[model samples]
Target: MFDFTPNPTFGPLQNPDLKVPTAAMDAQPETIIVGAVIDAISEQRLPAGAKLGEQALSVLFNCNRANVRRALAALEAKHVVELRPNRGAFVAAPSADEAREIFQARRAIERTIARQAVKRIDADGIARLKASIAAENLARSRRDKPAELRSSQNFHMLLAELAGNRVLQRFLAELTMRSTLILGMYAREGHSCAHCDDHTGIVDALIARDEALVLDLTDRHLRRLEAELDFERPVAVTVSLKDQIFGS
Candidate 1:
């Protein structure tokens, strides 16, 4: 179980009035469901270990229980959600060791990505980075933690995209989702360590084509986020699975 406040960023999935296009729904109901769950997790509106009931998800997504089952199985494969033998699905709650390892792996992957991104980033890439950072700043200014978190995650994902390596981009996406779980479980502040200047500094380094500085800032930024978590005393909040997804 988990508790969640409304997050505007989940508009498409949460809005009952918004209908899915028939062709897209027919083509990928399971994939759409999978993306919704992952987005909830990544936004931290869905906490670690929150039960993902098939019936509830089916109702929310306007799909069948079988589709929900398939979606949960797909999430299980990504390691962001777990399916117990009899207990059904819950978000995966990584241990402190796993949390550490996740960051370590992120650092390695992102360092390579940062190097590549700095080398290849063009004017358009720089503009996109600024737009993302501006969105993040606006969310933070409004105290919209969920939107802020999503924007913060997107900033990193953008870097992965700019890096031009599909494999590393995919890996970073998964790692970022896992990091959300880690933050939900262990963060003392109940949000990310995404200070405004942290991203700005990284972008500046990218603009200047200073690879070494970018790497150092990126590593330190991640390490600072990791340090903010209180692993020994994991904290969790409870809410209805439906509320967590559709926002109450």
Candidate 2:
């Protein structure tokens, strides 16, 4: 059964009958709440299929139920959360096929970005990529999985930004978030290559303005990541309801 316990911040109003606060009625709430929810999911602090209790969220953010509803509606539009008839909002749980499709789409998008980025890449952009690579190396040395993962992900995002296509960048951001969630659900521990040299190869190709080489390296990198995924079974796990509500 799905757990729907309220967080401690909303403890006082655990009762559905309790009235929501009126203070948040006058201001904007959608952006803040949506960001919080997304951050929670991305960090794996909130597990897949966990219920997003509107009342608890309202209290946690010090907003009214109306604003909380608006935030959830926004998440629904992003496909980050789904609304069930009797179950309310829950984090999206992607199937194995869907996960494979997301990676395929990501590879296409990123490969295109890498090709274009080679022509438009500047010294500053190259420096940023170098910094990201350095950060990833540091994280690997320290054995910090989260940091290593984020740094590797940011490298692709930096490439997209360098391509100077805002629309592609936006879409890539959403796709990357979904990919991260899929990885969290299906990845094996210690499976990621934290000290990946593939990124450096892409950067080198970009510096040489070799679009073909850049695309080839990007495609190979993504394929390597996909090969690491354990798809034989779903690895989804239930997180503590208390930790979900009141994060450390």
Candidate 3:
């Protein structure tokens, strides 16, 4: 929040404008498409298993089909979308086994991340994490599910940033995306956005540099999130791409 370090590498977060471009844009057209789709999916605006038609995306993004393909490729690498051989891309829907593996990976990698982050996080990083929690709280109050999801994701990403490992950060990005995809597909009805108390405890432990406590809280936090998912249930297939992408 206040005078905290800024994150220049926040992916899937940069704004996306779907309207036809009347002039050359500052960012690459592919970046715009990728960010837009990621934001939509991360915010749960794009539900799991929703198809992402390249033609429609190109039309809406005011770019050629080639640009849309590149964007989808980027999303595919991140495990956000599954690109089929004959069929086009769709929002990822991880299998139940894949889901467990994802959480298991998060538990392993995030524990190491938490250890590193608590060691290196300065006062500024702590403050920013606190600010992120506050922002998440506000998003919750406003009943903004999309914003809440974004803030919740941001909170975790902030920890990854504090860990000072770009490789782990990048790996977690893919895993987190896939984990959310699984949750979107199989999470029980009325399961709300992630609880913040665990995050708060983690931040406290990190601030205190209590390695054991930080590790414990981080593991518990992820396990709680995983427990919320119910693989027995499935999200109905959504055919309306517009409704899926924009929630309109």
Candidate 4:
């Protein structure tokens, strides 16, 4: 149900007639395209299970099919997209069961990170977290929901990094993206103001080196977020075929 019309100010070229010279190719095209795609997905500008038509992407990004494939492959590796054989690629649609499993997994991983972070958190780590929180507060104040939501999510990833476990950190990063997508698909508005406060509590506990309290706070935080979603409705499959066929 997301709109795909090109924004006149910064829209991707819609079916440009000129070919991009391979010799003068921009290696950063994939990165740029992927970032935009990710932002769209995060904001629910692209809905769950929506088809990411390769031809459309090629035209949108003004890149060739080859680069579009590469970018999509990367997104797939991150579990952000599912590549079906003859059906082509679509934004990943996580099942209800998968959503529960992801939240449970996040609880375990985030709690562990919180406990570990308390033991090792330094001045720099605290500073970074404070900056993240400040940014979240600013976003909330300005009613920038996307920025607030992304910042709130990034705070957890920052905690994982503070824990200094590269393996766990990488896993959390990927899971975080998938979790955001799931929330966008299912979560209701005015779910909880606790998201911001939970983050503040965790930071306080970390600063105080209260490992046990940090673990408890993180567990509760994850549970509170899970409770916000209206999962009773069946997974939404509301993409428009016309929009897919003709550039919107």
Candidate 5:
């Protein structure tokens, strides 16, 4: 289950609703734990390389260490969390090469998605894209990084959905989650990775049903975002695991 809340300063932020009923948590503790960790990672609250201790997580999620271990194993299988021998689990940190590869994969996949989206997007689809852009703009104006990043990801995922390709949508979902970690580590400070104008232009071309133009814009926008990352200067921001997951 998920819940979204509107922020007074920006627009609505779609953070995971962590307040699960005890019954549900007891039934699916691993699912709840995995979701909370992913949400935190996507939002940059759980920075790359942040330690996810079993004891702390078990306490925070009101579960046992076994459930936390299973959840960590699930996250590791998804490639979003890394488990080390005797060291426990930490958020996955992509190297410079891995980061470039992820973006390259995104460009290839998203261009195809944009082409299909142009062919299939209707009035409702365009409205959704525009709404996402508006929310992104509000987040940028307020410097709400997490919300802005979430909005950007949602826009791309929406395009994938409109493309009507389940396989590509699933692939893009994984790539986007991986990109969040890359961005958290390498994106330059004070830079908007997904510029609002670029998204608007893509939407414009989609409205015109210009497949070639959409493809060009999508490629260029992704390249620009990739260029904004400083591979040589990885930023190491740490957050208290419990605090970031729950609250300060």
Candidate 6:
């Protein structure tokens, strides 16, 4: 499993006092549990290969162990967590090969999504992409790496939405999270490619309604992101998942 260290951009990892009120707390315990895990992973509250103890999550969420297990099962289904018999669940740390495959899948799917989006491109879509880029720029200006990363993810999610294909959107969501883990694992020394200025180029092409350029831009954009992965660098230092999430 790839490891993750404390990213200054992600802020302090331990947030035991962190409390998020969930409406799902009432009718859907699993929903809350799943949301917590995904949020932690997306927000860097949980690093790659972090442990996810049923007892701790049950206590933290005031849910039952069965519910915790059920939630972890769902996360496992989404490739967000791994369940190891006799060991319990941990945040997934996809292998180098898996990471490459995820990117390859993304390139294939995103290329198709790009073509679909070009046909549906509109003024509103262009506006939204700019807005997302603006948010990314603001976060960068503030030097908030985590926020910038979220904004970057949002830009791609926006594309998935514009693709007009819910199935592809759902599939891309999984790929996006997997890609997040991959990037976190093989992150570069700097944020040049990670910042995603190429997204603007994509939007510009979309605004021009150039299908061919959109395809090239999106493929190149994803390729740039994939290129940022550095197998030569060291994996990050990891910690126990229970301790990481709950400060035990």
Report the Cα RMSD per candidate: 5.7, 7.0, 9.1, 6.3, 7.2, 5.9
Question: Which scores greater on lDDT, model 4 or model 5?
Answer: 5
- Write candidate 6's Cα lDDT for 154-245 as tens digits: 89989989999999998998888788887887878784755367888989899889999999989888888888888876674345444557
- Candidate ranking under TM-score, highest first, comes to 6, 1, 5, 3, 4, 2
lDDT of each: 0.81, 0.76, 0.77, 0.76, 0.81, 0.79
Q: What is candidate 5's lDDT per residue for 1-248, written digit by digit as tens?
A: 32323222111112335435212555688988887777677767767877787876776667899999999999999898889999878789889999999999999999889888988999999999999999989998898987888898889999999999999998998899889889878888776554669999999999999899999999999899888899877455344545447753
Number of clashes found in candidate 6: 1
Candidate 1 regions off by >4 Å? 1-26, 190-194, 237-248
Cα lDDT of model 1 by residue, 28-123, tens digit = 679778777777777776677677777667767778889889989899999978889988888898888999999999999999999999999999
Residue pairs of candidate 1 with colliding backbone atoms: 2-238, 2-239, 3-238, 3-239
Global fold similarity of model 5 (TM-score): 0.84
Taking all chains together, the TM-score of candidate 3 against the true structure is 0.84
User: Which candidate, 5 or 6, would have the higher lDDT against the true structure?
Assistant: 5
Look at candidate 1 and tell me the lDDT of residue 226.
86
Q: Flag clash pairs in model 2.
A: none
What TM-score does model 1 achieve against the real structure? 0.85
Superposed Cα deviation of residue 11, candidate 4 (Å):
8.3
Residue 136 lDDT in model 4? 93
Candidate 1 or 4, higher TM-score? Answer: 1
TM-score of each: 0.85, 0.81, 0.84, 0.82, 0.84, 0.85
lDDT of 1 at 155: 94
Worst 10 residues of 1 by lDDT: 15-24
Candidate 3, 1-248: lDDT as tens digits:
33423222222222343322222455788877776776667676666777777766765667898999998999888777889987988887777898899999999999999989978999999899999999999999999877787788888989999999999998887787677677777888888555687888888888789999999999989988988988776555454635547753
